[model samples]
Target: MIRSASQGMREGRPLSSSQAPLNVVGEEAQSRPGSGQPAGTTQLLLLVSLAHLISHVYILALPPLFPFLRDRLQVGFVELGLALTVFNVVSAVAQAPIGFLVDRIGARRVLAAGLGLGGLALLSIGLVGTYPWLLFGAALTGLANAAFHPADYALLSAGIPKTQLGRAFSLHTFAGYLGTAIAPAVLIGLALLGGPGLALGVVGLAGVLLVGLILPMRVPAAQDGADARRRPAGSPTAAGGSIVTPAIVSLTVFFTLLSFSTGAIQNFSVAALVGGYGITLAQANAVLTAFLMLSAFGVLVGGFLADRTRRHGDVAAVAFALTALLTLLVAVADLGPVVLMAVMGAAGFLSGVIAPSRDMMVQAAAPPGGSGRVFGIVSTGFNIGGALGPLLFGWILDHEAPRWVFGAAVGFMVLTVVVALRDRWLAQRNSGAGTRGG
Candidate 1:
């Protein structure tokens, strides 16, 4: 039973009724039997991470097939582009609603269904080979894409031990990064073996096979549909608190700023280097590739730091601040090829270091049983930033101002730092308030 504030104070338990429920739930969550057996926890992480990887693979998979698609479908670039635009738009709009569904039904079932749906969409597109079918498949895949972050985070939070969550989160992110890095090569290789259809079919089949592997295995009790329904009324598990809290809203903004800053560099750095510095295309690409590879390695290192520290905001803020300085240096300084690669790679490393800390902050803000919707809401920021980033930076390039690409990225990073610090301050205040007696 949740005591009133006055009663709690008299009993020397100072938590408000609202706060007490979460504390109780947290204890229950941590103490649940079989929650952290190493083998089971590792299996859960592997499946979830692989699902995330496939989700990212699908995101970039189609672009490599564009040439084949254009030839086979006899479509113009505009139509093909519209398919991608539709994908992003649908994914962004559906994420929040899908998240709500995740909290209601259970992440495990939703995740399997999402993966199966996405695979079928890809396979159908490959088999059909028509423009309208392509559009439909793109939209369907977008909806499936919406489910990944919410479901993955929900499962990880409920299934993994609290002590090891940072590393799990980092590994999950690294898998997504790996997928993006490998997608073009893998898809193109498959295309070479047969055709575009073969490439899509193969990748799609992988998702379907993964679904089979996940369906029979047990998920955390907290994420089981029957278990959620059985929870006592008035508990945090039964009545999930508000999803649109100040902390969530702020985190959403922070995600958007973070996404925009990173997207600018990822989408435009090579072009910026080539045009602004009069560098060769090969050199520019080499620098960008180094940046990307180093970033992936940095994510692993950041996981250890995330596990060791409670000051996630400070870590994120410091990393973003350093990245901003590097961006500024790229914009204004003239450097040799070796020096450029080192600086840009260092910047990417810092950016990757922010990933685990970013997830930690989001987890900190989520109430028990609310991971799905909170992560869903915040992850929408990526789509928003992705949707807007091209227009902003492409315009800068079109206007013949490549240096501004780095400059704009730097500006967004600074904004990210401010938001990170603000979130940290808010968390500190809330923590202090919760500890004080009424």
Candidate 2:
């Protein structure tokens, strides 16, 4: 049976033990973004996950669909890259505004509308023969993805039990990752048998169905809008009248850097494998799928530790360090597909673990009434990294062999590890001090 939150933690929000292996705070993490979720927290997590799944599959539509789209549009590298740049740019820029809307209007309204429109946009992509029209569809899809995170996370923090936050978030991220991961194989297969239009239509129809399902789900947004209205001034103190803070800028930086590394890999990994080692697209896609699966596992484990460990920052540091080392190994070593897959999977697992910890830390560090703002800011940074990752990798790919791109990715991983270590130390010291003062 699932356990109740430990002492000092509130209902629906369990925190890691103060002295647990990577403990930062026992219950403090859960309480940071105050939750008054109705009794149906599990159901709430499912709804949140489902909402994300619909939008994420749409965002990830590019990967497997790329081969088909390239053939149909007869696009060159320059054109393909430009379309991607626009898509990522629009999405990155939209995160902050979308989060602001979430803060103002509540997540349910924003997310529902975004998902429905995004679903339509996905269908439109299948029909749009013009490059500009395709780009327009991509922008709409990005907008839908942007709408999901802020409100979804706020709802999760409010509704899900703290101890399960990691698992919940793992499931949350996996929703997107899963859709993205499965997309290549499924879409490719569909294309082989049915053609791009049919494949795209099926994918779009799936999103529409999900949106229809969620429309009737009736998610209550108690933690976000209602709370903001009730405490218009916001919570000024912790339980004992101490200041409540949420980590904002620093978490954003970490998330952005991490995303940069991942995005670089996403954009260039196929080319690198095919050009550098002469691997087939199917093989390359397999490697990516393995990597994503490991990442999902990493997230689940990381979330579990987030609620169990006392020193979360250090744990994050360790996770990033592992990712860096794996990246370096992947870059310089002339390993076969098996070894390469193993290392890549392990790297994804370790690095991916940072998701829940990062989210939890940022929410906890926010000053009163700023959760939406901070979440938005961090999300924008993440999308920015996503936007830049491809462009940067593409530049390197244009100038140098695939090895150079791998080296650049290694550099990103190293930088992220250093930043994560710094974050860990700061979170521990500040949280520890907070405990003593309280």
lDDT tens per residue, model 1, 1-438: 734434643554323112222111223322236532323566788999999999999898788899999999999888998898889899999999888888788888889988999999999999999999999999999999999999999888776666788888899999998998999999999998999999999999999999997776556655665335444466654666567888888889999888788898888888988988978999998999888888888888888889899999999999989989998998888888999999999999999998999998998877666788889999999989888888899999999999999999999999999999988888788889988944
Indicate the worst ten consecutive residues by lDDT in candidate 1. Answer: 16-25
Query: Which numbered prediction scores highest in TM-score against the true structure?
Result: 1
lDDT of 2 by residue, 58-173 (tens): 76666666777788888865676566667777777887777667656666667677777777886787777666778888788777777778767765655565566667877888
**Each model's TM-score?**
0.90, 0.81
Would you list the C-alpha lDDT of every candidate in the order shown? 0.84, 0.68
> Top lDDT: which candidate number?
1
What would the TM-score be for candidate 2 when compared with the true structure? 0.81
Model 1 — TM-score against the truth? 0.90
Error of 2 at 313 (Å): 2.0
